[model samples]
Target: MESKTVLYIILASIVALGIVVFQYIYKQKAKSKIYLLLAFLRFIGIFGLLLLLINPQFAQKTYTLEKPNLVILADNSTSVAENGKELNNIISKIKATKELSNRFKITDYKFGSDLNILDSLTFKGKNTNIHNSLSALKDVYAREQMVTLILSDGNQTIGEDYSYFKAERNNTIYSMVLGDTTKYKDISVGPIQTNKYAFLKNKFPLETYVSYQGNTPVSVFVSVKMNGKIVHRENLKLNSDVNFKAISIQVDANSVGIKNLEVKVSPLAEERNIKNNRRSTSIEVIDEKTKIALVSDILHPDLGALKKAIESNEQREVSIFKSSASKNVLEDVDLFIFYQPTAKFKQSFDFAKSKNANTFIITGSQTDYTFINNSNIGIEIENGYPQQEIFGLLNNAFTKYDTASFDLTDFPPLISDAGPILITSPFETLLGTQIKGLNVQQPLLSVIDENSSKRALLLGENLWKWRVQTYRNTNEFINFDEFIGNLIRYLTSSKNKSRLNVDYEKVYQGSSNAVITATYFDEAFLFDQNAKIRIQVTNKEAQKSQTSPMVLKNGYFEADLTNLVAGEYEFIVSVEKESKTAKGTFVISEFDMENQFVSSDNLKMEKLAVNSGGKVFYPSQIEDLINDLSTNKAYVPTEKGTENIVSLIDFKKLLAIIIIAFTAEWFIRKYNGLI
Candidate 1:
C-alpha cells in the first residue's frame, strides 16, 4: 500500500521490477515454441520467488507521554507525635492531587511499622518500620514504573541497614525531612512494676527505668505519690545515651483493703510529652491468718531456736510438747514443726493425722529409719552417712551469691536445701520435696487436708546456727529473727490469681498478617466476667481509643489487631464485679513507618523511568518532564536487526498489486517465446 526506502525494501522492489518486465515480454509472444516454454518457466520461478520477498511493515506510534505514578508515603509513627498537625497537612495536600492525575497517579500511604493506604481510616498498628514498607512495595511492583516520594523525619527505624545502604551506595533515597531536626530534651519512663501481689501493710519494691534524649543535658523529677500525697521523690540530671539511670521505689502496699495505687513522674518543662510520665496499677493485698503447731523432741539449743522462729509468725501458735510430758493434752492445731520428733511412733502419727496437721521431720542420732519410710514421707537419704558441707540449690532456684549466713560448711550437707522438690501421697505439698520414708525429701514443707487442714515447715538441717553468721546479702538475716520473719511470710503467702501475658513478634511492610494473639495464665482472671478492654493512643493530636473483643479459649481471651499503623499503643483491661476488681495492661507496637523509610530506599522509582526511556522530575519540574515526554526527546530509536514481523493492513492495495503481478508475469513469459 505504501513504500519506504530501506535496505531490504529496495532489494525487494528491484526484484519485482525485473519479474514484471520479463512477464510483459513473454505475454507478447505468438507461438508456443520450446524456447518460449523454457523462458516462461524461468519467469515463473523468478517472479514467484520475488513475490515472497515483498516485505511490508506497519506501525503506529502515538507520541503521547503520561505522568508516572507518584506514591507519597506519609509517616504516622509515634516518633512524630511531636510534630503536631504538620504531617496531617502534608498528607491532605497529597490526597487532593487530582490536578496531577494526567501527569502522575498519586497514592497516599499512612504508615508506622507498616504501610497502609489511607481511606476513611478506622484502626491501625503502632510503631514505625518504614524500611520494611518500601521493601514490600518494591516486591509488589518490581516491573512497574513508579516514583516513591518519602516525607518523614530523619530518625529512621527500618530499611537497608545503614552500613548496607552506604556500602551499596544506594543513592536513590530521596528524603524530604519533616520534623524540625532541632534537638529538644526529652525524658521518658519505660520500666515499671514486675510483681502484681504483695502482703498488706508491707513494703513492696517497684522498678522503673528513666531515659533522656537530645543533645543538651536536662534535669527531671521522679516521684511516687499516693492519693495526692508525696511519698517518695528524687531529682536526677541526665546526659544523652546514659544507661543505668534508674530509680527504685518501695511503696507501702496499702492495708489489706486498698485496691488502687497511682505512681507518677514529673516531666521537665522542655519535655516532649507528659501522658507517659505517669501510670496506675491495681492490686489486692492478702491478710488471711492461720494457727501453727510446733513439735520438738529434746530441749537442745535447736529447740529454743525453733520456738523463737515459729513465734514470729502471728498466725502460728507454737506449742512445744516434750516427749516426757503427760499425754493428757487435747490439741487443735493447723501446722506441726517436728525437730527430731520421732517418738512412740503410733501415738504421734495418729495425733498428727487426727488434727489434720502436716509434719516436718528433722533426722538426728536417735532417729529410727526402718519404720519411717513405711509411714510415707521425706526424701530417701539411703547413704545416711555423713557427706561434704558444700552449697547447692535451696529448692529449684539457684543462689549464685554465697554468704556465711547459713554456715553449713562445718557439717556434711544433704543436697543443700531448706524446702522441697518432691511430694507424698495422702497430703498436698506447700513447698519443698515429699517424704519417701527412707529418703530425706519428704514434704520439706507440706499441707495436710484431713481434719484441721494444717501446713508444716521441715528444716532439713541445723539452720539456726547459720542465722548467727556474718555476710553482706542474705547474711543480714543471719539472726533467727530476720530469717524466721522471711520464713513465716513465705508460708502464709496467698496463691489465688493468674497473670495474663500477651506476646507476639512485630510485623511491618515486609510482613504478612501473622497471628496477633494474647494468652492468660492467672486463674484469678475470670474469663466468664465480661472483661472490657480499651486501647489508649498518644501519637496524634486527638487521642484515639478502641474496644477489644472478649473471645475466650482455654481460659484466655484473644483479639486479633491486624493492619494497624506503626506505633506503640497500650491496652487497658478492667474487670468489675460484686466482690473483686482486677485490671491488666499490655502494649503492641509496629515500626512500619520507620521501616518504610528504609524500604523506600531500595525502590528505584526514578530508575524505572530511566530504564523505560523516560525522564525524572521533581514536583516543580513536572511541566518539563511532560513536555519532553510528548516529543522524541526521550524515546530511544528501535534497532534494525529485529524487524521481521512487520505487517501492512491495506486490503485494496494488496489485492490490486497481486492481480497486476500475475498478469504482467504471464504476458512477459509469452512474449519472450517461452510459452
Candidate 2:
C-alpha cells in the first residue's frame, strides 16, 4: 500500500474508535457490562466496513520447478516392421525408468506419413516421411529446453532427405538404428517423367532412369505396356562404372479417353526388393481439336506471337486472315480474334455477332474507338486521349480461372488509349491497370459472359513484349504460352454450361488420399450455400458400392476416398432436391512406397544425429542411450516464479464477520427495549 492509502486507513480507524467511545462511554448516562460489549461490536463493524471501502491489495509470489522435456518419436511405418524390428519393448523400458521420469517431462509420439500421439502400434503405413515428423516436433518445442529421440530405419519415400534438415533452435537429437544396414543387389524404375495429357493418334515421350546396385555388369530390358499388352521394349547395358541409364521411349496414343500404362525393368536374379521394379501411370487422350481464326487488317508481330502461343498445344490450330476475306472463313472458325478492329473489320464483327461465336478483342492506338463503341460490343470508351503505356497488376480475386502461376509483377507495359473505359455487362477483371508506378482503378484485361456467349477484351497491344520478357526471366516460353493457351481454351470450350461442377484427378497413388471436390450454383450462377451434395462410388472390379455425403468446407463440398482399395472406381456426385449430377471414373494403382527399400539408410540417420549435436546407437545399445540422457548436464530443471496482487474485498469470510457483528449489536439493542 502507498503512504496516502496508509494514512487514510489510520484516519478511518481513529474515526471509528471515536464514534464507539462517544456513544458507549462519553454520551451514555450510565456504564454497564452490556455497554462494553456494544462498544466492542460497533468498533469492529465500523472498522471492517471501512477496510472494505479502502480495498487494499496484498502481493503474493509463488515459485515452481520446470523440468526439461524429453520427446520420444517412434517410427510406425511398414518399412520398420518389414525389417523385423520392434520398438514397443524399447519404449516401455524408457517409460519405466523412474530416475529419468523424475528429472524430465516425457512425451511420446508415433510417425509414419504424419505425426500423432502414441497409441497402439500396427505398423501398417504405406509411406514414410521422416523429415516431416522431425520438422513438426522442432516447431512444437522451439525456443525451449528439449531433448528428442528418433527411432527409425530412416527409409523415407515421400519427403525431402532428413540428413539436410536444420533445427531452428538449440535441441539435442538422438537416433536409434532399427534395420539391417546392408546394400543388396537391386533394380528400380523411377522417378519417371511424362506428360499427363496426350493427343489421339500421336506419340508422347516417356523418360525414366533405370538404376542398378551391384559390383558386376548387368543388362536389363525396359518395356512399356498398355492394357496388359507390350507396346514398346528396349535393352540397356550398365556396369559398375555406369550404374544408371536414362531411357526414353515414345508410346502411341491410339484411342480416346484415359490410358493406363506400366513401365517395368527386368530385375536381377539376386534382387530381394522387386516392388520398385515397375511403375504405373495414366494419360488422358483427347480426340477433339479447336480451330481459331485471327482476323486483322494489319500484319504485326503480335499476331505471330498469339498464333505461336495458341498452337503450342497440339489440340489447337490457328489461321490468320485479312479482314476483307469472304464470310466463308467464319463458317468453321470456333473462335475469332479481332486485332485492333477498325472500319475495315465491320463485316467480320457483324458476322461473328450473327453466328453468336466467342470473340477476343484487342485494342490499341490504331483502333477506331467511335466504330467500336457504336458496334455495341458491351464496352464503351468516353473522352479518349493520346496513347500511353499501362502496366498490368494481377487481380487476386479473379475466380473465373487460375492466374496464380503467372508472374506479371515486372512485365513490360502495353500501349493503350488513356481514358475512362466502361463495360455495360457484368465482367471479371484478370489484370488491373497501373500507370506511371501508380495503380489506377481500371481493368486492363477482362472477360465477359453474357447471353450464353463468352468474350474477352484486352484494352492494349504489344502483348508480344510480355512473352519475350517471360522467356528472359524464366529462360523458357512455356509459362507465357500456357497462360495464353488456357485463356483461349476457356473462351472456345463447347461443353454444356451447368450450375454444378466437379473436379478430380483421373489417377491416384494407392498411398495418397483421393479427394473429389464440387461447387453448386443457383439459377443466377452464384454460389449456392444451402446446397447438400452426396457421392456414390462403385468398385468396377469387385462390384461393391457405397454412398456418403460430402462435407461443406470453405465454400465447396469435398469427399475423401482414401479408404477405397486399389482398383478402378466409378463415382457420381449429385445435389439434393435438384436434378444435377456429374459422373467420372478414376484408377488407384497398387504401389507400396514403403516396400521399395532393401535396407535402412544408415548414413542419413548418422548425419541427422551428428548435425543436431548427438550420436546414433543401435537397438543393442539402448541402455547406453538412456544413461547418456540421464547424465547430460545441459538437461536440468529450472525454477519459475509468478506474482499476483490479492485484494481484501475478495474474501467472503471478512464480509460474513462484518454482517454478524452488526446483527448482534442490533438484536441486543432491540431485546433491551432500545429499538
The candidate maximizing lDDT is 2
Task: After superposing candidate 2 on the true structure, give the runs of residues whose Cα lies further than 4 Å from its correct spot.
Answer: 1-19, 53-66, 83-85, 142-144, 168-170, 290-450, 454-491, 494-496, 636-650, 659-675
TM-score of candidate 2 to 2 decimals: 0.70
Badly placed stretches (over 4 Å) of model 1 are 1-69, 77-100, 103-105, 121-126, 142-145, 153-173, 177-227, 234-300, 303-336, 340-359, 363-408, 412-675
Clashes of 2: 0
Each candidate structure's TM-score, on Cα atoms with residue i matched to residue i, is 0.45, 0.70
For candidate 1, the lDDT comes to 0.49
- Tell me the tens digit of each residue's lDDT in model 1 across 398-500: 2322222433333223223232233343454333432322334444434333332333434355555544442332444434454455545444443433454
Q: What would the TM-score be for candidate 1 when compared with the true structure?
A: 0.45
The candidate that achieves the highest TM-score relative to the unseen native structure: 2
Q: What is the Å distance of residue 630 in model 2 from its true position?
A: 3.3
Displacement of the residue 637 alpha carbon in candidate 2, Å: 4.7
